[model samples]
Target: MKSALGKKKPLELEDNVCRRTNVFKLRGNVPNYLEESGSTAAFQPDGWGYKSHWGMAVNVYSTSITQETMSRHDIIAWVNDILALNYTKVEQLCSGAAYCQFMDMLFPGCISLKKVKFQAKLEHEYIHNFKLLQASFKRMNVDKVIPVEKLVKGRFQDNLDFIQWFKKFFDANYDGKEYDPVEARQGQDALPPPDPGEQIFNLPKKSHHANSPTAGAAKSSPASKPGSTPSRPSSAKKAAPSSSASKSDKDLETQVIQLSEQVHSLKLALEGVEKERDFYFGKLREIELLCQEHGGENNDLVNRLMEVLYASEEHVSSSLIKSMNSPSSRRSTDSPSVSDNFRFV
Candidate 1:
């Protein structure tokens, strides 16, 4: 056999600082490529080479080649089309539930979809959804940084930029699988009704005639269906709750009495304050009426009063202001400068 030792090709290894894994699995309905708004390079069959997504040598995965930019309209359309809803702005994504669904679309079963509250109306609830998204990101080991603090504040630029970055990441890894946004959410915001017992903690009644807490609870209790007789608890089972409820009701009544007394006192104080305000206002109004009766603004006394009125609220000396606004002062202010007649031409 011919000697193969010297004939062996020198071992050559390429230095790839930005190394990437050739094998990766992604499931998404969107095309697996990023492009500028109007350009469809990677999306076309000619551009779909081995390096690209769709075809066989065209290196479509070259990020440096495409100067992709997402406009507001394009981002909104992408979001609406993927989520199957109408979202006029990206700031609405503050709730974070939609982002949780995004993770689900990228990596199915990464999060419990039902836990996301689409109808969450509070800031804390929004934070909760974001926390869930963070946890999911941790589990998936995604390298992206999420600015939860800035994002939760719902700033337009912050959220828009984040969404744009996410759009690029999504396009690169998407496996071209069909995903149903509605079915993935399993009906958004399936929150249970508020318990009748919890309504007791609501803000105190603002009406003049406040009802007792027990009465309010009774009113809030769910009513029986039409023509259906309501069932009563047995005496054995009801005795404990009856005693406890009575004790609680007694405490509530005491609180109500104390609050009512405080409210009454506040109302009386307010009335006294109003009377004082009116008394001062009436005195000023009477002086104004007297000024009008004498000779309107031109009268000397009226002018002096007006001067005092126009001056700062601090006490002013009678001599500080002139008795009337002279025509000489008016002419000085209104006429052109004396230098106009003697310009250095």
Candidate 2:
């Protein structure tokens, strides 16, 4: 139950940019600061508490990750083993109250073995070069924590200039969505009254001559010489019953085929659902028998079995048939009657 951080030594180093860098390296990436030549430790980015000639102060922390890893308890035991192997110097770093406090604030209580084992390596380096570690974290400026924003990114010029540019960009692209009425009106020309129903007046009338033949011609053509027109025969109404009937029959066949397939699919689904229901019913009966035998409630047995199996009620119930056949479950169910008989005797 003890925290890994709780096991670390608590140290209040000189609060400055350098010390902050050291803390960052310890907490973040320590192996990155390791020296290749066994000379002064070098952190590629300067803020990470690596100083030239600060021999042995820098710790190189590294760890491996696994797919299914150990719990914090297992990790703690592993860390203790690592400390024993490493001459106990690194172990000293973790044991101090200062390191403890730092870890307490830095990590959640149960850190995985990966992060701790990695930090343990750094702890080893820190112990070897404790003085360098101290200098790495030593303050160069009055400020304890470095202003990473200003330091990492070059200081920006007056923000007012940027704001001005943004305003110019906005004005150029402004769509009158948020325009002030008075200011917008000042920039606009006076509007004229709209002509009423201009669309209706301008719309061309639909031409009857264009749609109908004889009637339109009679209306539009010069009055045909009064008696010149002749009568014409009317066309017969068309019917193709045989073709239509055949087409309808084919359509009905297709629909019947589709309906049959749908019915078959539905039957399969229904069968599956029925099977599942039956399984659950069997499980419930088995649980009932178990409860009666054990002098326990059926509902309680069901709930307990569901918990033990880590399955839903339906799933557990479905498996009850198997449970009923199970010798162990049947024995438990039978044991209760014997107990009751003994009591009676």
**Whole-model Cα lDDT of every candidate shown, in order:** 0.57, 0.34
- Which candidate number maximizes lDDT? 1
TM-score of 1: 0.40
RMSD of each: 26.5, 29.9
Winning model by TM-score: 1
lDDT of 2 at 7: 64
Candidate 2 lDDT over 1-345, as tens digits, reads 112434644323343434422323333333432432243544434222443442222322222132233443444343344222221222122312222222222222311111222222222222222222122223121122222122111122321222222223222222233323223223332221122213322324565335434344346546436877533431121134345545666775686678678767766776675466455545644663464355444567665653443333345566776866888665545457422322110
Task: For residues 1-345, write the lDDT of model 1, one tens digit per residue.
Answer: 113424643222234322222212222222322221222434423222212332221212333336566887899789878877666677777777777788888778777777677776555567668767766664564545577667766678887878876776566545578999888777674232122123233445575224444456557667667997545664464466567668877887788788778777766776675466455545655674576467444778796875554343223444334423544434454577533333221
